[model samples]
Target: MPTEHVLPATGPAKVRTRPVRIGVQIAPQHASYETIRETAAALEDLGVDVLFNWDHFFPLSGAPDGLHFESWTMLAALAEQTARVELGALVNCNSYRNANLQADMARTIDHISAKGGTGRFIFGTGSGWFERDYDEYGYEFGTVGSRLDALAVDMPVIEDRWTHLNPAPTRKIPVLIGGGGEKKTLRIVAQHADIWHSFSDAATLERKLGILAEHARTVGRDVAEIEVSTEIGSRSVAEVEEHHALGATLFTIGITGPDYDVSHVADWLAWRDERNAQGPLAW
Candidate 1:
């Protein structure tokens, strides 16, 4: 892999833009806050394009009960600590906070990351899953369909709140909606997201992208305008290339609790640089 090329903000003149981005999801579980802060900074310095933490009250892997941290508050602090890399919860739980409050918190963090310019905060959201988070946090754990229905209702409210905020957001804060449910999740993505993220294999991604495109037509949105994102860990670089061909430019690797190791990141970073060097159409 080559070291000369870096992620371009846009493709060469006249070509449509498709920047290969790498996002690291640092799970906020089974780790000390001090350690997590240090790791966040290190990942930015190591050239990660984005930093992400899942929205959960407990560990998602390893021992069931373990050291964990809250998503939003930690994001607020991360906003101040990292200067270049974009930051956000991988997918914040929509059921945990009022839609208006969620909007306000994102705006505030967006401001925190912005040093008098467009902020680097990605407003990644989803209808809540992980029933344990809801049960323990006192939120009602509704069925997936109902949760998705609530998300559809809350999205417009969140956008409205953004408009009413005193400072507003530095930029339109790219909203990333995660999940691939055709009935509702993709529909919400069509109506609200600037980014649509999912964790699907090639065949599934192909089918879902088609469904997402149909959703876009219903909402009168052009499917191409929405950036595609997906998560990959324990997968080969060949798989990454396959997903890129399927419209996923943003690839996320999730790290679990306790040992937030990034030893595997170097190869992916090299792959990104090499692939980007071949020109935007190489993927």
Candidate 2:
């Protein structure tokens, strides 16, 4: 593998004029598939821009052995079930499957979700982290560095497989990478991601983005081309606004379990409308 490059930071972060998009990650744990299925439909009907699920074999919270559905398989089902929302795993684990297999699965789901026009699949992926997921599923629970290294190696192969697949993915299938590792993760984001998802607050996001820009410059790409995405879990509107001011356009709220209360979703939708109504070019 080629050594990843890190260059000196230069220039202020570019201002983005993209319209704000709200996303919801319906946690698949502790809920029946029927409940999850219904929640996905409800979110789309409520006008969320994207729907996501985590890629894990078991629940990250609540009971350890709670009812949990697989990410990609449920995503394929959601592809047929929903009409408007773009959907994918919030971040699929690169260690779970072969790179080419991941590409093919994503392509099939892309086609399944297209509804005869364009697909709504966004390939959000990351290096594996959860230890139990690896142990229970018989995958190597390597160190973080090794897992990230594997991801770096797999990405080009995944992208290359897309080119050679029989019926290519619809609309080039936007790639969303989730991580904030300055040297490794951001380098992958700079090289391949159309959107970068991180869990940073405004100040950290601002600083990390400067690092991201340096990586982009090292690879001769514009950092502004990668959309900034952040989680809105329990964040107040004002807090989300802080991130928004720093050019993070895609905000996702996570709702979990049987009830899957969407009371908060309406607030986010309203925020999205308020931002977008200012016009795309509006600061």
Candidate 3:
């Protein structure tokens, strides 16, 4: 029987009030491995805080037959090529690999990143979605609730195995959970995630965050410790402030396709620096 790790009721830490972090998800569905490599290095040179790739077998957009690459393999390579900047999948599917294996893989990459300085590997994951990945990869595609159940079971197993591995991770691997299902998903976020990501608009994000806080209280956890993140399509400085007011300190801007134009990353980097200079806004 799997042991249930009851989360403490203290809630998340007040880290959101710290310096804001800006991240970019390098869409892997439409670029070649070489282009992806160069893009990752360039993003680091441009001073983006974090870089990410998606976990998928085929293209999520564009023509179904368009270029696509595996997530973890590319991440391992990125871990080696880049000297700075954190790296991880924007979200890896929990159902694809065994929990222990996932831990080992993450440990290996953690070592790869720790070569010069501190290791920076954020383990971003979610309950597996996209039926095509399941059918093609030979994994079971169960109901969403079932998948979440599996995630709840596997997360602790991964954490436990990390301790007993031959060489433990140099730094605590931050667990980033992505999704916005109110009941189960938010509950999981309150209980386990160090970071919670959602595709919510500012208004919706504010509303859902309130619910998440309530869930955290119910679970005897601190909501403040969990970093709240959302995707941005536009770079309106005011919109960034609006989300920051809602307690979102980490922001990810996703850029897609054949030409992974990272020109906007410079703008975001500038905005991040400006926000840092201003200090945390009073909400």
Candidate 4:
């Protein structure tokens, strides 16, 4: 089983105040839709807190032309399929769709998942990265700055559209921004995100948190209001503990498809339960 890898402690532990939650990103490539849907159902049954899919037109790894499903449509299907798990893209590319349209789609899915009460949809998004997705789809393949700039402009439009919609979202849709770019990305996260997801290691996360806090302060928003989320792929328990100590409450594992093996998931879930059982602290 792949376990969380231990890394050198960068500094003193920070108190974790939020409940620990486990998330899994089901990479929607190189597998049939039936298999993917089954995997989603299975993971929810295993008690995962969040389910995510990546936004891309093609396989990120393996055969470039392998079988793949689109993120938003698949997410809608998953919303109807699963009852309890919150689901979204790990990071939906903002460049692909119009801002109002994206917001409407998210709102629709939110309603679909609500069933009766609050929605289980989280809108996790980021500035575009993959060039091919843009090239083939004919979106302007602008530079990183341009894409991030576009994202900054579109976020408010999305939020405003949500407010104007006839039936506003069942609940305030949680916005999860995925990136670590200090200048533009983190600033946008401070302004908009309910959750900030990053792939930073312990030391990097600590440093970036400082930057994010500064951005939040400049924006007159409390940094503590944003949840800290980290990708904890194959890292050992001790490493995960170190990240937890640094205040990352949501830990995610990404699994790719074909045959999505989940034998190791129980280990992570056990760790999650253990952390929850113990309550948040600097261990």
Best by lDDT: 4
Model 1 Cα lDDT, one tens digit per residue, 85-110: 99988899999999999999999999
Cα lDDT, all candidates: 0.85, 0.88, 0.83, 0.89
- Candidate 2 weakest ten by summed lDDT: 1-10
lDDT string for model 2 (1-283, tens) is 1111122234743334578899999899998998998889889999999999999999999999988899999999999998889999989999999999999999999999999989999999999789999999999999999999999999999999999998888878889999899999999999999999999988899899889988999999977678889999878889998888777888999988967999889988998998888864322
TM-score of each: 0.93, 0.94, 0.91, 0.94
lDDT of 1: 0.85
Off by over 4 Å in 2: 1-15, 281-283
Better of 1 and 3 by TM-score: 1
Tens digit of per-residue lDDT, candidate 4, span 1-283: 0111111235765454578889999999999999999999899999999999999999999999999989999999999999999999999999999999999999999999998989999999999899999999899989999999999999999999999998999989999999999999999999999999989988898899889988998999878788888998878888888788777788999999899987788889998998889954643
- Distance from true position, residue 170, model 3, in Å? 0.7
The sequence of per-residue lDDT tens digits that candidate 3 reaches over residues 158-264 is 99998999877888888899999999889888888888897888888888888888999999987777888777777478887777767776789887778899888
TM-score of model number 1: 0.93
For model 4, the run of ten residues with the poorest summed lDDT? 1-10
Output the better candidate (1/3) by lDDT. 1
Record all residue pairs in model 4 with backbone atoms less than 3 Å apart, i.e. clashing. Answer: 3-235, 4-235, 4-236, 5-235, 5-236
Q: Candidates sorted by lDDT, descending order? A: 4, 2, 1, 3
